[model samples]
Target chain A: MSHNTEVLDQKTLWGGGRSPFNVSYGKLMIWFFLISDALTFSGLLCSYGFMRHKFSDTWPSANDVFVHFPFMGDAHVPLLYVGLMTFILILSSVTMVLAVEAGHRRNKKEVQIWLALTIVGGFFFLFSQVWEWAHFIHGTEAGAIKDIIVDGEWVTQVVHGANLHHNEYGNVLFGDFFFFITGFHGFHVFSGVVINIIILIKVMKGHMDKTGHYEMVEKTGLYWHFVDLVWVFVFTFFYLV
Target chain B: MERDDIIEYSLDISHTDEEGKVIRKRLWKVFWILLAVTIFEVGMGFMFAGVAAYKDMLMYTFIFLTVVKAGYIVMIFMHLGDEMSYLKKIILIPYCFFIAYLLFIAISEANFIFDIGWVLG
Candidate 1:
């Protein structure tokens, strides 16, 4: 019994009782979940790349498509609004990491402040996405005229905006992909805001303090950072590329 | 199996002022790097507009810069850099392989379809 107790004492830190990766169970699970989620996103992006490559000649340039800024009033500025959106998301990511850092210090006030900032950033990004999507669906004033067969008769029609079946943009797949990817990413940001709000409430209630740890905030930070990371890819592939 | 035992073992909080400063510095550095890369990407996008000859080059550059940005976000912001080296490898290696394989298949298959003129012709 004495020998066994001595071995246990020496191996306490490395024992099976602790995580092999030095991460808590919740954190490890979050990492794994993020990895799987990344694969799903990559799958979508790859399919988009394939379709874009296949329609290279007729692929609508993103610059020409996403050129509206709020209150800019028909002044064509390409990539500017999306650039602002990217800045917002990246800034939010910084604030989120700062929150995690403050949590590590057990500074409830700092954590709450940073978390609130993150939620605000997330709301801004989500609203921006809504505005961008509305512009995409509304399209430009001139629109595009295409001949389509209706009831066995070829008829010429003007299509102003985008839908699932047709787009004033060059290719139909362009609108589809845009809606799918950005809508999906927007959904993620919304969920992230909800999660951040929950975490903030918990912080306000001193739940983390009661537990004597702030690991929950860290887990939510991981998730928020993942959302930001996905936006980085989407901005590159969908807008810039 | 007590809650205190779990907290004591699992918490990796930095208690030192110097350590906190170091972490904050690193985080801000990463933020600056991400910002610079994004601005560079937007600038290049503007410069490459209507320049058909440089389309391929622009695409490649954007991809490269994006990968760099992703690296910073994943490593620093996600705290992967502070994890065990083996843990880092386990998370990153599979993603590297999966992305490469998917890109290869996507590019080659799309090229083949385009060459055949199956849809466009």
Candidate 2:
């Protein structure tokens, strides 16, 4: 991928020197912002890992635990439903890409259409998550995973009311963190979708075209892509392998 | 270094000139590379699943590959790579450090829980 200038490019990346080329201060600031944001997400995920490791022997298998809807009114099925949700999220990411394309061309109508699609996709994902949370909270109790050991390693072999309610899966800590982390992430996506929709409305009014800049679309696209990227990891770590 | 190169790099497929006229470039080359890498990823995901040498190790490899794909999209597709190297490093270092630190704690905490052996045998 390197051309004649590859060696020179390396001087910046390596050789203990700053960049040979100049970039804007805005772009550099954005980089720093993304860096901090990335750290926040990493910290949350890492905590999950710690808890997962502690429960390794009796840890719930993602597939098995996620199987069966809790409030399905006595239905029996597994995995297919969540798979559909994943498909929805990924497809929405594609639509966002289309919107980015349209924005580049100053295709206002096209941008609106694509943004609408992406917003719909976002809503669909959120709905799926809510359903999943309900099932997680009040659905079929997990099989492979049973009982909870407190932070001090005291196993509480008790089951009453719901899974996390009485003490089925483990102590309430898992449930607490689950709601907090996923809920926080979900809230972010929810807000991001709102912002995009607002921009879509503005684009329909021709604000971006009149201003001769589509930086809004570009910045929002970055945020959307990051959300999708985070979910890709969450899907693997939280749901699948 | 040409206009088309800049355009081609910014947009995935082709680009236009100053007058908004289409400028056909050999953009398919980049597409081919991306596709080839994606195929390798799919192959690795499936192949490594069965190796069982160390499940965690394979999982990390998969994560690494996924990061590579993401990096390509940002650097090539999003034009981030063309920016100043200082900018790129600043953004990437924090991101990597954040993710790494979180994952470290995740594994450590999970390990501590497993040692309890209170839930599963």
Candidate 3:
């Protein structure tokens, strides 16, 4: 513990006390937290693979599991919708970088405007996620449903909601893990939006330039980008893989 | 503090233009690199997507590329690359270990549970 304390104490003054590693306290913590959180996510995805290997025969494919959009009422596009989501997220990350750049130039208005745009992008991403979850839960009327007994209660499940065989995308465990992983990731993006909002608020109120610091913005940019990075993995593993 | 040394915390990074539109040249270069990398990823995604050969291998390769691209964006674009290599190593090497450890434990435990379900139940 003493050694640990010493390590932290030594690092507490990094970046000549100006940078403190890219941004400030909020973002620094977010990065460290995200690294560990990212590890957790990697673990979850790794388990997904293990389970997939065991169920190689009957296990549903990713393309079949998430085929259609909710309320679209027509058409099955395998990667089309997810590809769009990826586009939105990547664009938002670009805007976040722009916001950080604007801050670096000391252009408050530009920074504020860019931040607002990023927030809009974040909200759009969240809305899409909500729809995805809703589709996962309720499924479509066209697909076959399953009844499984849980604790003396009968529960309904979607069996191949995306395909003709009507094989459940996963067993109860499948549904459980899917919800756990994706939902957790979505929550991170949601919380990130919340943080961006707070940062935007602080910028608008003129708090950053006062102390001769926009490390806050820089740090937040790191976090926002990290969120985007994790999604790339999610896309590859959950969708593309 | 001297004017030059006094870090203006304001949003104004402009040293030349009156409107404060100035930006570092490196930002554009980084943006272009990121875009190029994204295009490559999309290409790989489409290419391997239809073919069944080495699906796992392709996915792992893409993941490795993503990690590389993300690290570059953080290091070069974000200027962590400019810092002493020692510091960069300090931050990154441990996180790699953690990811591996988490991957092993989580996957093995999950498989273990699934196995027990089959044998005992």
Candidate 4:
């Protein structure tokens, strides 16, 4: 009886070697973490969607709500600044991927340059978010969205500035949601920037070069991209929709 | 001398490779695709604003475009497109279902609240 005795490589279906998923353990773990993080953001956004839908008629329009332009003194520019912030964040994501590609080739200098630009981009985004948060809290000249009797008729009231309890935009709930969601997202971006700075220092110091690979950069790139991805959804659900 | 027999050592500044070209091209392509989509979304937002008749249609469109942009970012930038099929499925399947479940529950509850007229009424 002839026996089939061909030895299978460790990569074979039954044989386990190094990376069954065809990716490193670090990358796989990052993917898992990101998936969970995504669920959290989705929950928050869905809640926003639900509230807005229920108050479709009474909800403040994004156009009338987010019309502040920096240094323009009450010009109704609509989504211009937020749109620019979005573009900058997207550009930063592009730079991050470029850094990852450079890392794959073990090009340390390219990695450093790209990473620095990415950090700058991250800082810019963070600053923009802070400005936005401040503007949101300070609101337009009108005030918190409330009910006021005008000429013996009850009508919607617009006020200036907002806190956890009061909102100058539309509904107090709108202010609450805005602060919680955007603040949460901004914190993520801040963490990403901190991580990138750490990685940037490592690259500049040639630490990654001694390791013979740039997997750390790639791993961080995965995270930064995930942050960018979340912002896309947030911008839509909050700013556009 | 056979070209395939030559061993390549990647330096900090070396830019010579056939494979690198392909990757760079793909990177540029992804950047352009993302930029184009953002511009398109902005244009649509401007066009459809203030038109009461198109409110529902606008919401659906925004959601669709947002999904498209998110897909491209995940697939390309996150390198999921280059990963194995099983790995992709392992990550994507659960995520899609979970988000859908959340949306379903949240929307239903919001509608219930609306019907009860507790907050607004």
Candidate 5:
């Protein structure tokens, strides 16, 4: 016990802050958190894939479901608005990286401009999510429940606008998964926007500039990129596939 | 603080030299790649919508493109590529195994449920 106490006192907890990995402690912690978060997302996506494969025949085609574009008035443009949303988010990510680059050079003006653009991008994506959710909840065409004779009894089947118990978009579980996954992702976007805004304020006020290293901007860039990364998967698995 | 310390904190003039231009070029490269992939995805979606015969192939393609886009974003935009290779492996390798495990379990369970004839639609 005494030997262990001496070792601990000399190095582990009592030593000056050191990163044996050659990375900053803050960055390492963030990467660890991101890895864990990735696992959570993977679990959700894999479960979604399993459910999709099991109900392959009856699954609602994403094209059929997300055909509405803003002000198109039932023009049936499949994936147009969602595609726009994806592009906007990606563009924002570009701005964020640029901002990080500017921070590296300590260009306050460039950082402020790029960070502002990123915030705008985040807002647009979040707005698109709200629009999509509204349309999904209201449904494009009011679906009807059909009755089919199965085993000498009428089986009532519902098909479009989704609720907690039922969904017209093929399976209730599909709606459940869609809402849960996208909603969670949207929440992340919302949080990222808020964080960006806060950091932008800090940059504008020269608070972060005083730190010599704009690691805060870099950290936020990591987060924003992770959000974009997750969206890429969501776009493929949910909308495109 | 000393004048030298203040000077060091206030400005890193070397960062704005040739390195800044390279950084800008890299940022644009990442942006263009992501945009191209997205355009391709949208184009495929438009072409293959309601086409039952091409569905599975299209899905596979989308997955491939998505993975590619994600890898680029992680490696470039997130600056993970600039990190030490060992650190990169430490962060990425375990996630691969975990994903495989998750997929195996969920897919197998889904198949078992399908075999048992319990489906929700």
Candidate 6:
């Protein structure tokens, strides 16, 4: 009886008046959403792995394929540009965490500055991806020669670059996976930038100040970090591995 | 409780100059760690290119390093490390099992298909 009374007297953490996770509903929901998104990305990556393994003998080596560096005509610098992209994304993730920290202190100016830097980093990354896609679509001078059936007749032709129909790379599926996975990730970064802009505007308008908390910034920071996390996997599995 | 009251109650924003400094320091540390690991991976990739003997080892190393970087990003940047222990488990535990199972299934299936000489066809 005394133990029950003591338990009752103490503050009940899970008695329905407060969050059991010690997080706001919005933040909790964001975490759940990120988890689900992570699984979806994993599914795509695993399928990529399956296909690559199935075509192990003829799979295109990522190093040989991604050797183009801007302003270095015909230079074979493997993984350099993508490495730089990874660096930019990680740096932006740092700025995003700093913004969330500033929000914790209710420092509006710092949050705005950091968030703007993050947005700039995002745009730079998107532009780099566009440049990469352009180079990928434009094949090398010495493209691969392969046999293909056109209008019920087999023809031998030199295929340059990549598209849904075919790829200069060994397997056509490589181009498909590259387009789908990276395109999906790029879309995420685009949406993340848009969300960050909206949040920055809200901060500038003193919305967070009025609310007496910066949970919104924290939530968005979670999302931005998630994007960065996905990129890390893509960089490794798709490029380095 | 009112919605505003719930929001107010859930607000965990407590900050100080010292706390901010510590956080900034930690964030920079994670950034450097990620940068170093990436450089190391690239270096390894360059060094071991076309080395058939070390192919499996290099692939495994890359996977391990990638997971380590992911851990840092999630724990520190996403602030999952500061969340309640149960919440952390709730978010992480399932992913571990789920990814492992999916990879196992996909790889085994791919291997079976490759063995039967059906992949290229």
TM-score of every model versus the real structure: 0.92, 0.69, 0.75, 0.87, 0.87, 0.94
Cα lDDT tens digits, model 1, A1-241, are 0012222344464566655566667878999999999999999999999999898888899999998888999998899899999999999999999999888888899999999999999999999999999999999889999665568887889988787866898888899999999999899999999999999999999899888888888889999999999999999999998
Model 4 bad stretches (over 4 Å): A1-11, A144-158, B1-16
The alpha-carbon lDDT assigned to residue A101 of candidate 6 equals: 88
Q: Evaluated with TM-score, which candidate comes out highest? A: 6
Q: What is every candidate's C-alpha DockQ against the true complex, given to 2 decimals? A: 0.51, 0.21, 0.25, 0.32, 0.40, 0.55
- For candidate 3, write residues B1-121 as lDDT tens digits: 4556432323322233333243445555665666666666656665556577867777777777677767756675454564445446756789778777866776676577666665323
For candidate 5 chain A, the 10 contiguous residues with the lowest summed lDDT are A1-10
Question: Mind giving the per-residue lDDT tens digits that candidate 4 earns over A1-241?
Answer: 0011123244473454434555656677899999889888888889898988687657777777777778998777777788888899999999999998888777788899999999999999999988988887777665545775568887875657766866665666787888898899899999999999999999888888786778789889999999999999988988888
lDDT winner between candidates 3 and 5: 5
TM-score of 1: 0.92
Worst 10 residues of 4 chain B by lDDT: B5-14
lDDT of 3 at B11: 31
Q: Say which candidate scores most in lDDT.
A: 6
DockQ of 2: 0.21
Across A1-241, the per-residue lDDT of candidate 3 in tens digits comes to 0012223344554646444333334544656776777677777777777776455454555666676765677576566667667778877887887787777667789889989999999999999987776667666566566775557787886453322222356455556666777778888889889999999999999998786656677777877887887787777767766
True contacts kept of each: 0.63, 0.25, 0.19, 0.51, 0.63, 0.68
Clashes of 1: 0
- Give the runs in model 5 whose Cα sits over 4 Å from its true position: A1-18, A146-160, B1-14, B119-121
Q: What order do you get sorting by DockQ, best first?
A: 6, 1, 5, 4, 3, 2
Candidate that beats the other on TM-score, 3 or 4, i.e. the better one: 4
Q: Write the per-residue lDDT of candidate 5 for residues A143-223, one digit (tens) a residue.
A: 858454457886896544765556666766788899999999999899999999999988888897576778788888889
Docking class of 2: incorrect
Alpha carbon lDDT of residue A198, candidate 1? Answer: 97
Model 1: colliding residue pairs: none
Per-residue C-alpha lDDT of model 6 across residues A92-188, encoded as one tens digit per residue: 9999999998888889999999999999999999999999999888879899997766788888899998887778987888999999999999999
Ranking by lDDT: 6, 1, 5, 4, 3, 2
By summed lDDT, the worst window of 10 consecutive residues in model 1 chain A runs over: A1-10
Stretches of candidate 6 above 4 Å error?
A: A1-11, A149-154, B1-10, B119-121
